[model samples]
Target chain A: MLALAFQLARRDLRSRYLGSFSGGAWALLQPLVQLAVYAFVFGYIFRQRLPGADAPGYVPFLVVVMWPWTAFAEAVSRGTTAIQDNASLIGKVALPRAALVLAPVMASFAIHGIGFLGLLLVMLLAGAGLAPAGLALMLPALALLFLFALGLALLLSALQVFVRDIAPALPQILMLWMFLSPVFYGRYVMPEWVRPWFDLNPMTGFAEYLRYALLNMPAPGLRAMACSVGAVVLVLALGLFAFRRLQRHFEDFL
Target chain B: MSVLVEAHGLGKSYPRVFRRSDRFRSLCSLLAGRASGEVTPVLQGIDLCVPRGQSLGLIGDNGAGKSTLLKLLTGVLTPTHGSVRVNGRVGALLELGAGFHPEYTGRDNIAMAATLQGFSADDLAARLADIVAFADIGRYIDEPVKHYSSGMVVRLGFAIVAATRPDLLITDEVLAVGDESFQKKCIRWMEDYLEQGGTLILVSHSMYHIQKLCRQALWLREGRMQASGDVFEVTQAYLAHHERKSAADEARARDLDAVRGLEFHVRAMRVNGEEAETLPAVEQGAALTVEATIASRDGRVPVVNVGFARADGTPVYGVSSDMDGVQPAPLPDGDFRIVLHIAELPLLPASYTIRVHPLDSEGLRLFDTVERTLTVKGRSSESGLVRLAHVWEHAAPLSRSRGE
Candidate 1:
């Protein structure tokens, strides 16, 4: 099953940029362009910065959170439509159906993860105040974030097979989710009453932890960390349960 | 022999999703672990057991669920009712270019298909040259599958399946698209595969192919098993049903009341003592008695003619009383009765129609006709309408070749 998932992920990645001139380089380049646009809008125009005077630059602060968020958002949006997109394959071939959902998630993470690593290396050399040791320390957090995205992906992809509105509405929902999370700004920028409520949003733990690891910023509270971990475990279990229950009926509806 | 495939009360039904709301409702119910309501059943209650080395043909009309059964057996589609257990690796070529991604090159699709069949990368690499060679599509192997002709698609599809050499092969009418040469190559490969103890399940509209390849056959009609057994019997029965359906359509166009007004018309026609539109099936070489009662509007002698034809309207033989230098015997009620009996009917096993016509005394100017369907039942695989009487000369006995 793992081998099949890898084969499908490779196929998915190759087919995405098959006819393009830049080919796979576009996977990394697209996110770089998005980062440039965000840097211009927030760093230059809005003059967004971290709270403390000793904080790292605005671009690195945004880069750490934005890259992982892009991976999560792309993974969820692409994975949601995986089953519906492969309706012809599911009806004709007998294979592990979950692999279809897993492929897109794996592809998203692989492309964005490589881009994130390369950008961090470049920042470290540019004297952006990023801790070299924190890069090693952040591996566990990155792995956890992958599981969180995968859990949501499995859940949404299964629902998308039956309710097609999920795929079309996913982009708007992810945009709202990103704005609500601490992607563009820190939770400290929000009003005092809402600061504590940020713990409920799983992305809060992720965004704060990435900054804390790489930018030497304040870490997320223990309650927020526990809440995010609990959410991942609960969502993963629900996703697996829903997927296993609904996978067999996919062909009938498709 | 160990069974390679076993299915019991297998069935499938699609949930009715005419409205958008139904899909949502079905999702909710399915998630709640309840059966979705309002389903249209496409197949039901199919029981099959195919032993290793056995070749089975699936014969059915369009929409008869032959493809559905094949999908269930191959584990492509989940059965809604019962279970199917397949104990070996199965290779299936369902419909045209099944499991092929249109945007991918044929070579790429082969790798994907090989992976789906549980072949490791090394296994596919070893057989890659053989697959490309067997397909024989030349440079089209590197072209996108959507750009290839339908015949080329089947060639590539069949070549991959042939290379897999699965323990059980299930194909669904895909061979019909291939050119004759490619088709012959596939059949030759399948024959060799079968000889090596591979099991097969085949679906084809052409009974000739079924009879040539399969030893056992199953007939499905309206999602139900009509008949299953020896290939000859099931295929013959399926063909006969089709023949009767077409004959019935033709029979509806000719009204009996309109024919009664003719100068001389056939009043009744019977085959083998039974007077019905369709008679019971008769064994091959069995005696057949065709009796016809002709009514003459005027008190004049009428000549009777008996003709045998395949149900598709291919005439086999025709004979008239006048040709035999005889006349129909007149009855007291002013009707003429003629009986034509063949000591041994030489017709092969298939559906045939017997036509009785009343003509004037001169054996010309046929007035009216009545037809009855006769089915010949046997295990003979001989081709053509009738069996010819002949002898093989200077032929050695089979035991002599084996030195028994």
Candidate 2:
């Protein structure tokens, strides 16, 4: 099953890279354009800056947060229809069901790799000092973010099969989710009272941790990071549970 | 032979949701562990078994649940009731190019499909050349499957299934497509597969192919078992039933056509002086008699025509009273009765239809027809509609000569 999953994932990644008009260059270009837009709107127009310290310009700052955020959003949206879109496979083939859900998630992760490269380049051009030790921290933060995204993907993909409205409603919801996570601004921008509410969003700790990993910025404290990791584990369990429960009826409905 | 696959009272039912809102509601209700909507049964109480090394054909009309049964056996759909136990690995071609990623190359799709079928990466590598050779798609194997034609897709699909070489091979109408030569190749492969003690469960609408391939057969009608037995017996029975049904339908349609005309009408028909009713069974060399009564408008004798045809609508022979220089005998009520007789029927062993037609006295045009189907019951090695009365005599062989 694992072999098949990797095989399917590799094919999916290569095909998506080749299926579009721009091929793999589109994967690099999309995040680059999005980061530039965020930088212009927030850094130049709104003049937002990191609180009480040296700021690594908004483009590099936004790139750090957007890298993981984009992956999570893409995974969730793509995963929503992973099983439904493969209705032919489900109807005609007997395969490990979880592989369908994982394929899209892993594909999203692969694209994220290209986006991270763009982030690294933007940081280098912005003259952010290279801190190898601090850079190592990105691994744990990125791993946690990947797990959280996969969990959401598993849950949402199963739910979308039963309730089709999830597919159409996902983009707007992700837009709202991006605003709620501090993709454009720092956590300090939120007033103390609203700061508690900000921490309630699991992605806040994630974005803050990723920024800290790359930019030598302030972290979300130990409690927020622990809570985020705990939430990741909890969502992973619930996602798998719901996915296993829903998949048995997938053939009948799909 | 050990049992390869067994299904005891297997069934499946799908909930019918009439409206989009109702579909959402039913889905929610189902997820909530509550009864959803009105259940429509697709298949029910289907009990069957395929022994190892046996070839079983699943024959059915459209909507008779043959596809559903194959799906159940292959574990694509869970049975609603009872259970199915399969003893060995199963490779199926349930649909052409199913599970193929359109954007992936044919070779890539083959690797994925083979791996999903439980072949190791190394196993796929070893068999890659053989699979590519069998598919015979040539350079198209390197192109994405989306660019492949339907036949090409089936070629790649069947090639992969062949490479998997599972213990039990299940296919649903896989032989229906592709060109004649490819279909012949698949049939040849299937023959070899069966010969090597491989179990097969084939589903097809073509009785000829099924009879040629399968040793045992199961016929399904409206999701119920209609017949299950030897291949020849079940296919023959099913075909005979189909022939009678279609003939009746055609007769009804022709009856409407016969009502519109007033000049000539056929009233009754008899075979061998007995009223031609349901299909009557006869043997070779039997004296065949056909009598038909016709009514005319003006007390003039109308030409009567009798014809014979195979049940599949192939014309065998036709003769008219006018052509034979025989006049119809006048009846009491401006009606006429025509009697046609054959001293010895030369038809081979198969179902046949005798058609009676009324025409003008000159036999220049045809008016109406009434048909009766007869089954020639005796068996012979000869084929086709007629049994030619001829003999072969022994001859001595001559020695070969030098270059002419």
Q: Pick the candidate with the highest DockQ.
A: 1
Q: Model 2 over residues B1-404: C-alpha lDDT tens digits?
A: 79999999998888776677876776677667665677788888999889889999999899999999999999988787779999999989888778788878888888888888888888999999989999999999999999999899989988888888889999999667788989999988988888888889999988778877788899998988999988866776676677667665555546645444667778888998677455567878888889899977666788888899877777899887877678889887768997888899998766778988888776776777777878876534355679888866796655632111
- Report the lDDT of model 2 for residue A105: 80
Q: What share of the true interface contacts does each candidate keep?
A: 0.78, 0.63
Candidate 2, position A38, lDDT:
69
Candidate 2 wrongly placed segments (more than 4 Å): A20-22, A48-54, A57-60, A117-127, A134-136, A212-219, B250-404
Itemize residue pairs with steric clashes in candidate 1: none
For model 1 chain B, where is the 10-residue window of minimal lDDT? Answer: B395-404
Per-residue lDDT tens digits for candidate 2, residues A1-254, read 67777877788777777878899888888887887776666666666344522344556677778878888889888888888988888888988888888888888887886678656865666576634565577888878877887888888888777778989999999999898888888888877888877767788888888778777778897777777888999999988878876777777666
List the candidate 1 regions with Cα displacement exceeding 4 Å: A48-56, B252-277, B291-302, B327-339, B358-360, B365-371, B390-404
- Residue B156 CA displacement from its true place in model 2, Å: 1.8
